[model samples]
Target: MTYLNTRGSRVSIRMSKESDLTVLVIGSGGREHSLVKICLNSPIVSKVIAAPGNGGIATEAECHPVQVDDPADIVSLAQRVEASLVIVGPEVPLAAGAVDALEAVGILAYGPGKAAAQLEASKAFCKDFFARHGIPTAAYGTFSDVDSALAYLDTQSYPLVIKASGLAAGKGVIIAENREEAASTVQEMLSGAAFGDSGRQVVIEEFLEGEEASIHIMVSGEDYLMLPPSQDHKRIGEGDTGLNTGGMGAYAPASIITPELEQEIRDTVIRTTIDGLMKDKLDYRGTLYIGLMLTDAGPKVLEFNVRFGDPETQVILPLVADDLVDIFLKCARGDALPDKLNLHPAYSMVVVLVASGYPGSYPKGDPISLPDQLMRSATLVHAGTKINPEGELVTNGGRVLGVIGTGPTLKISAEKAYALVDQVIFSTKVFRKDIGWRQLERKPHKA
Candidate 1:
C-alpha cells in the first residue's frame, strides 16, 4: 500500500514498511507513550504517530490531531499514512471495533475484535467466558434488576467484588469489605445512575483472598505467547488505602509465580482462553491482559483487557529487548513467534503520579516540571496531559506520568522510580509508598 509521501517522493511500501515501519498508536495515556518510545527505538521503525496523544507523547512521536475515541479518524489516519500497524492502547477503541474497522480497509490493527473485546467491555461477559471456557475463576452471578441483586447478596460472603457490567474505565469495580458495604455497592450499581449505562447491570462475586498479578499474552489467532508477569497497585493511597483509581503503580517480575506455577497458569488460564477464541472463530490479535488472583485454591481470573495494561505496560515494555514493531507486524499477519522473545530479566517498577483530589476531581493546568536531560534517566510516560494553546503542559487526566525504572532488583527499581518522581513536580501529586510490599515475604500463595 503506497501512498504519496509528504514530499511526493516514491517510497515502496508493503501495507506498512517493516523497516522504518510507520506505525499509528491510538490512545492518550502513559501506556501509549511508552509504546511510542519502544517503537521509535526499533531499528526497523522509521516513524511513530499517535492520535490525540498527551504532552509526553508529543516529545517522542509526531502527534496527530484525532480524537482517540473516534475510530473513523484513527482508521483514516492509518489509511492516509499507509501505516503498517495500528496499536490500540485503551479499551474504548477496542470496544468501538476499531480493529475490525482498520482491517476492513486493508490496514492491520493490533487489537482484539469486538467479540473478543467483550471480555473487557462487560464484566458479566468475562464471567460468562470463564464459565464457558472452563477457566477457573471466582464464582459470581449477574443481575440487571435491583431487587434480584439485593436478594442474591443475602447468601454471599463479605469482602465481595462488585463490578459494573459495562465499561467503567477501571473505576467501575468496587471491593466492599462487609455485607453492608457489599449491599450498598449492589444498590449503587443497579441504581443505574451511578455509572451511567455502565451500571445498567452488575456482577457480584465471592472475594478470593490472594496476591494479584497482571499477565499479558500476545495472541495470533489460536497461538498464545505470554509476556513477563507484572503487578499493578490499583488503590489511591499508601498501603493501598483509599478509593481505587485507574492504577497507582506497578512492578514486573513479581515472585508470585514460580517457574512451575507459570507453566500451570499457561496451561490453565492462558491456553484455555486461546482455545476458546479459536473454537468460537474469533480472531484475536495484539495483547490480552489477564488479571489473576493467585488464591489458595488456585489462580483465578479477575479481568481481561484487549490491550496492554497501563502502569503494567510502563514496566513490561522497558524490559523487552526485541524490536516491538517487527513483533507486532508478525502478529498481525498470523506468523508464529520466534522460539524466544528476549526480555531483560530485571526488576521494572512504575509509579503513577496523580493530581490532588484525583479519582474525584482535581486541579488542572499545573505546569509539571520535567527533570533536566542529565537527571532524567528515568522514563516519564505521559498519561493524562495536554498542551495549552499558550504552549504550557498541563494535566488532562486523573493519572499523569508513569514513572518507570529498571534495575538489578525490585528494591533498586523502586528506589530509582521514586527518585525520578521526586525530581518532577506537580501540585498535590499523590503516589503509593508501598509499591512492592505485597511480595516482600517471597512466599507464594498456599495453593
Candidate 2:
C-alpha cells in the first residue's frame, strides 16, 4: 500500500492491509479500554483482545489473564492468540522489552524497544538525550548521593523541581517551593523511603513556570503524526492543590495551545525529536507522549512517556474517527502516516473517579452501583474494576473509572461528564468537580 507524498515525490512501501486480523492490546487500564474501543471501530479488526483487562474492556474484547510485565508471557499470549498486530498500552511493558520480544518472534507490535524506552524509564538519560540533541528543555542536574545533591542545591535558588530518575508510577515528581523543602525531599527520595529503587538516582531541575499540555505523536523512524493537543490535571485536589496522582481529569483539544503554538511545537519539538532519534539510529516506534510546558519564550519539553497517557488517552481517542487499528499497524510497520489525521468536530472531557485516599493507600472490593434511570451519551470507561463471585462490580484500583462526555462546546461537555459521574456510586467515591476548568474560562476557538 502507498500514497503520494504531500511534501515531495511519491514513496513506495511494503504494507499489509489484512481485513481479517486479530489485534492484541496489552494493559488493564482505561487507556487500554480506549484502545480497544477505537480498534473495534475499525472495519479490518475482526477481533480485539485485551490481556488482564478491566471489567468494561471485558465487555468489548476477549479478556485474558497474564502477567503484563514479563516479556515472555506477553509473547506467548500473542502467539497463542495469533495476533497480527499488538498495541501496548503501558510503559512498564515497553521498558521490559515487550515489543522487542514480539518482533523477534515475527509478530508486529506498536511500541518503542527497551533502548529507546530509556527516555521514560530513566529521567537522567532523558535529560542527557535532550542536551545531546539541543532540544529546548529545562536545565537540570542528576545526583545519586545526598551529599552531592545537597552540595549542588546550595548554589541554586528557591522553587526547584525534584524527580526520581526511574519510573514511580507518576508520583516521583515533587515541586519544592523553598530550600528547606528541597533538602528534605531530596533526602527522602535518596534514602529509599519514598519511591524505593526508582528514587535511587534523582534529577533536580529549575522549576518551569507555564501551563502544561499533553501531546501524542505516532512515530515511524523519521515520519510522524500528531494527535490533537490535550491537558490533564495531575494534582489530586481541585484548583491544582495537593499531591499529584497519575491524573484526575483531562480534555482535548486544549484551548491554551493556539494554532501558531501548535505549529511551532510540531516544528521545534516533535519534528526535531523524531529526526534526532533517527540520526542516533535508535529503532523507536509507537506513541511518543510529549509533555510540554508552553513558556513565554517558547515550548519546552517537560518529560517523555513511551506510551499513551492515562486520562489523556481517555479523552483524546473519543475525538478520533480514523481506524486506530490501521494507524497502529502502519506505525508498527514503519510506514508513512496519512497527511491529515481525522478527528470529530467537537469537544471531549474525561473525569476520573477514584477511591478515597488515592495516590496513596485506598480500600478496594467496594460494591459499585450505576443509576439505571439516567440516559446520557457519556461513556464510562473503566480502569480498576472487577467482577465479584456474586457477579457484582467492585472497585479494584486507585483510579476506578473515567467518565467521558462530548459535545459542541467545552461547558456542555464538562457538564455532561460531571452528570454521568454523579450517577455512579461506590463505598468511598472521589472526583474533581472542575474538569476542563481552564478551557471553560477561555474564549471559544476552533479545536
Candidate 3:
C-alpha cells in the first residue's frame, strides 16, 4: 500500500524479505517480547531490533542494550538503522510523544500521538471525555481537593474506586468499600501519602458491578478493527480477591459479546470513540484499547488505554490472523482495509507468573528454570529478567513472564496453561489458578 503526502510524494513500505526497512521495537517486557516474536515470524521482516531488551527478548532479536525511555537515542537509532517501522509497546513512550518525535523525522510509528495520549495519562481527562462523547462508562466525578471528593463520597454508596490521574505503574487505584476506608483513601491521595504527584487530582468513580473484559481495536482514524475479546484477572488471589497487581492471567474469546452484541458495541462505543476524537480535533492513529465491564445493561467502558494493555496483549496477539505489519501500515495511512480480519479458531490463555508480594514491593534476582520449545508447547514472553555478564538469568523486575496455552476448547486451553505452569520453576512464583472461569461456561459464538 502506498500513501501520498500533501506534496505529492509517495509514502511506501518495504514489506518483503529483501526489504531495506528495519524494525525497531520499543519497550522491554512480555508485551514487547510478544510483538518482537510476531515481527520476527514475519517473512517480510529483514532485521528485528530491540532497545535494551530483557534476557528473554535478547534471544529473539538483536538487543540494542540502551535505555528504553531515551527518546533522543531512540530517534538516533532509527536514523542510524534507517528503520522502516517503529512499534512502541509501553505507555510511557506514547505519553512522552515518541510517535510525534519519530514522525517529525519521517519515521512511521504504531501507537497514538501525544495529544491523543492524555486519554490514558489523565483519568480526569478520560472521565470528562466519556461524559462528552457519551461513551457509556461508569459514573465518575473528578476533584482536585480531597474535601470535595470526601463530601461527594458521603452522599454516594459504599465501595467506590478512587484513581490517581497520572501514571502510577498500575498501583494508582484504590477501592474503598466503607466510610472509614474511603476517608483514609482520600487522605492518602490528598496528603501525597501514596502515588506522589499522580494523586494531585483524583477521579472517584462509582464501583461497577459485573465481570471485567478487555477489548482492543486497531484504528485508522474513524475505521476500526476489533480483536477477539479477552478477560484478564487483575487481583492477585483466586476467586478475584486480593490487591490488584498488573494482571495475573488472561483468556479469549470471551463469551460476553456475541456477533450481534459486538456489532452493537462497534456501532455505539468503538466507532463513536474514534469519531469523537476526530470530531474533537484529536488525530488518534494506531491502536485504541477500551477496557470494559460487561454489565447487566450492556458493555460500559472502564478505562481507555491509548496503546495495548500488557497481559491482554500477550493473549490477543496470538489469535490475530492478519499480518501485523500490513494492518499497521493500513491504520497509519488512515485507509479502511478489509473488515473481515481472521483469527485462530481456537482459544488462548496466558498465565502471568509474578514474584511474591507484587502490586507492592517484591523480591527480585530469582533464578528461573524454563523448558525449551515454548512456542510449540506454550508461548513464553518474558517481562522482567536480565542476562548477566556471566550469562546467568536474573530477575530485573516484577511480572516475569506470560506462559501461554492454545487449544480448540477453552477447557483444553486452561488445562494446557496449568500444565505448562508446572514445568517452570521460580522461587516465590505466583499465578491465579482460574483465569477463564466465567466465559468458558457460556458457549462462544463470535468474538
Candidate 4:
C-alpha cells in the first residue's frame, strides 16, 4: 500500500499477514507489558517479543536488552528479531527517532517520527504549537536561561507551573506555590541542578485549577480512534498532596468526563490537535495522549504525550475489546481508523506498588512475592521487576508492579484491585490506598 507523506512524497507500507505476524514491543515499564499482553492475546499474532521486558513480560515473550533511546540499536534489534510490526512503547525512543530509523529500513513501526514527537519531547515546542494553532491551553512562557526564566516568572502570578522543556520521565513538572519557590525552581532548572539537560530550557505556565482527565487516541493522519477516558494520580501521597511520580495509579473511564464533555473535547481539543499536525505537515501515526484539565472554561490541554501512559495503560488496555494487532497495524500503515473503538462496557483500575521512598532514592534487588492465585478480575502487570541471578523476582525500579482489576462496576474493580494489592508482598512495597477515591466518593451508592 502507498501512503502520501506530509512532504508530498509517496511511501510504501506493506501490511503483514496476521497469520505470520511477529510483534516487537519496546520498553521496560507496565505500559510496555500491557502492550505485549494485548499483542499476545491476538489470535493472529504468531509471536511476540519485548526488549528490556520486565519479569512478568519475560514469562510471556522473548526478552532482549537494548538501549531504548538509541535508534540504530532499536533498528538492529527489530531486524534481528524479524519483527513484522514494531510497537514503540516509550516516548524517549520515539523522540530519539526510533520510528524514523525503523522506517528507513522498511520496518513497520508504530510511532511518530522525531519531529512530530517533539510535541511530547519538548514542552517549549508543544506550548508554541498550541499557541500557533489556537489550541486551548494554559498561558506559558519558554526560556533557556536563568535570568530570562526568572524575569518571566516575575510577570506571572503565584502558584504557577514550572516544567523542564525536555522529557523527564513524567517527573519534571513542579507546582510552585510562591514567588520564592518559583524563582528557585527556575534557577535550579536552568542550572541543571534539577533534571539535568532536560531542565536547561524551561516552560513556566499558569497553573490551571480543576479536575484532570486523560484521553488516549490512536491516530492515523487526520483520523483517530479514541479510547475510554481515564484519570491518573501522579502525586506520591494520598489525596494528591505530595511530589509527583511517573504515576501512582489510574482508572477508566473517568466519570468526570460526561458524554457531553467528551464530545466537547473532541470538537475543541482532539480535532484541533490533529488539524494542527496536518497544518504543520507532521505525519503523526501513533497514540496521542492528551492530558486535560476540566476547568470552568471547558477542557484545556495540559500536556501531550506521544505514546501510551504508564499506569493509565495498565488499566485502559484491559478494557479494549478489539484486536490490538490490527489497530496498531492500521495506524502504522496510515490507514483510516474506525469511527469508534470496540471497548468493553466495564470499569478498570490499577493500583501501583512502588518501592519505599519512590519518586526519590530507593532500594533495589528486594525480593517480591505474589499470591499463588489471583481473583478472576485481577492481573499483576510488572513495571520494575527482574529475576535476580538467584532466580528470585526482585524490584528493579521505583514503580514495581501494577495490580489491575476489571469488573462490571467501578466500585467492584477498585475492591478487586485492592484485594490483589494486599496479596503482593515486597520488602519496600509502598502503594496509595485510595486509587479511585475521588470517583468512588462521588458515587457512594453506585455499585
Candidate 5:
C-alpha cells in the first residue's frame, strides 16, 4: 500500500520484512515493553526499537540509549533509525511535544501533541475542560495558594480528594479522610513541599465512590477504537488498604462493566470528550485513557492519561487480536479506524511485583533469578530492571516486573499469573496475592 506525499512524492507503506518499516518505541518501562512485544507479534512490522530499554526488553528489540525528556534526542534517534512509526509511550515526552517534533520531521508519530496533552499534564486544565464541556467528572476547585485552598476545604465535606495540578508520576493525588488531613495535604501541595513545582497549584475535588475502570482508546480526528475495559488495583496493600502505588495489578475484560455500562460510558464520557476536543480544535490524536469511576449515577471521569497505563497495558495488549503495528500505522497516518476493536473472549491479568518498601524508598541492585520457561499461559514483562556488570538481570527501580497470564477464565488467568510470580526470585520481591478478587466474586460470563 502507498500514498502520495504532500509534495507529490510516492510513499510506500511498510508492511513486512520486505519493507523498511522500522518502528521506534519511546520509553523504558513495562508499558513500552508491552508495546514492543505487540509490535513484534505483528506480521507487518519489520523491526522494532526501544529507546533506553530495560534488560528484559533488550532481548526482544534493539535497545538504544536515548533520553526520553529531550525531544531533540528522541527525534534525532528516530530519524537516525529511519523509524516509520514512532510510538510515544510515556507522558513526559508527549507533554514536551515529542510527537510534534517527530511530525515536524515528517515521521508518523502516535500520541497527542503538546497542546492536546494538557488533558493529562495539567489537572486544573482537565477539570476546567470537563466543566466547559459538561462532561461528567467530580466537581473541582482549583487553587494556587495555601490560604484559598484551606478556605475551600473548610466548606467541603470529609473524604475529599486533592490533586497536584501538574504531573507527579501518578503520586500527586491524595484522598483525605477528614478535614485535618485535607488541610495539611492542601498546604503540602500548595507550598511545593510534597511534589516540588508540580504541586504549586492543586485541584480539590469531590470524593467519588464506586468501581474504577480504565478505558483505552485510539482516536484520529474523531475516528476511534475502544479497547476492552480493565480495572487496576492502585493501592499497595491487599483489600485496598495501603498508600497508592503506580498500580499493583490489573485485569482486562472487566466483567463488572456490563454491556449496558460500557455503552453508557461510550455515550456519556467517551463521546462527549472527543466531541469536546474537536470543538476546542485540539486536533487530538493517539491514545486517550479515560480513568472512569462507575458510580451509581453513571460513569464519571476520575482522571485522564495521554498514554497507555502500565500494568493495564500488560493485560490489555494480550486481548487484542488485530495486528498492533498495522493499527498504529493507520492511526498515525490519519486513516479511518475500525468501528470496533477485535477482542478475544478471554480474561487477561497482570500482577506487578515490586521491591520491598516501594512507592517510597526501596533497595535496588539486587540479583534477580528467573526460570528458563514460565507456565504455558504466562509471560514475564520487565519494568525497572537492568543488566548488571556481571550480565545478570538486577532490580533497578521500585516496580520490578509484571507477570501476565491469559486463559479461558479469570480464575485460571489469575492462577497462571500468580504461578509465574512465584518463579521470579529477588531478595525483596513483593506482590499482591489477590489480583482479580472483585472479578472472581462476580459470576463468570455465560457463553
Candidate 6:
C-alpha cells in the first residue's frame, strides 16, 4: 500500500499475508504478556516471540534475553528471528530509536520514532508542545537548575506537581504539598538524589484536581481508533492516600467518560493532538496514550505515553473484539484505519499484585503459588516474575502479576478478579482491594 509520509511524499509498504506473519513483542511485564496473548490469538500470526519476557509469557511464546534500551540489540534480534512485524511494548525502546533502526533495516515496526516519542520521553517537551498547540493542560514551568526550579515554585501556589523531565518508569512524578516540600523536591531532583539523570531537569506544574482517566488510541497518520476508556489507581495505599507506584489496579469502560465527555475529548484533545503532530512534521504511527484529568473545566490532558498502559492494557485489550494483528499492521504500514474498533459489551478489571515495599525496595526470589485449576473468567498475567534455578516461579520485580477478570457487568468482573486474587499465593504479595470503587458506588442497589 502507498500512503503520504509526514513530508507529504509518497511511500510504499509491503503488507505481509496473514499466514506468513511472525510477530515479535518487546517488553517484560503484564502489558507485554497481554500483547503476546493477543498476537498468539490472531489467525494471521504464525508465531510470536518476546524479548526478556517474564515467567508467564515464556509459557506462551519463545523468550530471549536482550537489553531493551539498545536499538542495535533489538534490531539484531528482529533480524535473527526474521520478524515480519515488531511491536514495541515499552517506552524505553521507542525513546532509544528502536523503530528508526528497524525501519532503516527494512523491518516493519509498530511505534513512533524517537523524534515523535518525545511526547512521553520528556515531560518538559510535552508541556511545551501542549502550550504551543493550545491543548488544555495545567500551567507549567521547566527548569534545569535547582535555583531556577525553586524560583518557579515561588510563583506557583501550594500543592504543585513536580516531575522529572526524562523517563523514570512512571515513578518520576511527586505531589509537593508545601513550599518547603516543593523546594526540597526540586533540590533532590536537580542534585540527582531522586531519579539520577532523568531528574536533572524538572517540570513544575499546577496541581490538577479531578478523577483521572486513560485513553489508548491507535494512530495511523490522520486516522485513529480509540479503545475503551480506563482509570488507573496510582497510589499504593487504599482510597488513593499514599506514595505513587507504576499502577496498583485498573478498570475499563470507566462510566465517567459519558458520550458527551468522550465527544468533547475527541474534539478538543485528540483532534488537536493529531493536528499538532502534523504541524510538527512527526510521522507518528503507533499507539497514542492520553492521560486525562476530568475536571470541572473539561477533559484536560495530563500526559502522553507512546504505547499502551500497564494494568490498563490488561483490561482494555480483552474488551477489544476486532483483529488486533491487522490493526497493528495497518498502523505500521501507515494505511487508513477503521473509524471505530468493534468492542465487547462487557467490563474488564485488573488487580495488580506487587512485591512487599514496592515503589521502593522490595524482596525478590520469593516463591509464588497459583491455583490448581485456573478459572476461565480470569487470566494471570505475569509482570515481575521468573523461573529460579530451582525451577520455581518467584518474584523478580516490583509489580509481580496482574489478575484480570471479565464479565457482562463491572460488579461481576470485580468479584471474579478478587476471587482469583485470593487464590494466588506469594510471600510478599500486595494488591488494592477497591479496583472499581467509584463506579461500583454509583450503581443503584437492587431492590
TM-score of each: 0.92, 0.93, 0.92, 0.96, 0.95, 0.95
lDDT string for model 6 (1-447, tens) is 455654444444434554668899999999999999999999889899999899999988999999999999999999899888899999999999999998887777899999999999999999999999989999999999877787787788989999999999887888899989999989999899899999999999989989899899999888899999998898999888788898999998998898899999999999999999989988889999999999999988999999999989999999999989899987887888887899999999999999999989999999999998988889889999999888899999999999999998889999999999999999899999988888888756210
Error of 6 at 186 (Å): 1.5
Two-way TM-score contest, 2 vs 3, winner: 2
Query: Residue by residue across 1-447, what tens digits does model 1's lDDT show?
Result: 544322232323454334757788888888889889988898887778888788988877788787667778888888877787788889998898887778767676777877888989988988998899999999999999978888888888788889899998787888888878888878877887779889989999988888889798887776666788988888888787878888999888777777888989988998888888877777677799999999988899988888898889888888888877777776676666676668886888888999888889988888887877624336788898888888878888788788887787887788888899888787768777788777654555321
Candidate 4 per-residue C-alpha lDDT over 33-56 given as tens digits, one digit per residue, 9 for 90 to 100? 999999989987889999989998
Candidate 6 lowest-lDDT run of ten: 6-15
Minimal lDDT window, size 10, model 1: 4-13
What residue pairs are clashing in model 2?
Answer: none
Instruction: Identify the superior model by lDDT, candidate 1 or candidate 3.
Output: 1
lDDT of 3 by residue, 209-289 (tens): 887777898877766788888888888888888888888888888777677778878877887787789788777767788
lDDT of each: 0.81, 0.87, 0.80, 0.91, 0.88, 0.91
Stretches of candidate 1 above 4 Å error? 1-17, 177-184, 375-377, 440-447
Candidate 4 minimal-lDDT segment of 10 residues: 6-15
Model 2 over residues 230-285: C-alpha lDDT tens digits?
Answer: 99998899997888888999999898888899999988888779878977777777
Candidates sorted on TM-score, descending: 4, 6, 5, 2, 3, 1
- Which residue ranges in model 2 land beyond 4 Å of their true spot? 1-17, 371-376, 443-447
Error of 1 at 60 (Å): 1.8
TM-score of candidate 3 relative to the true fold: 0.92
Q: Model 3, which residues run further than 4 Å from truth?
A: 1-20, 374-377, 441-447
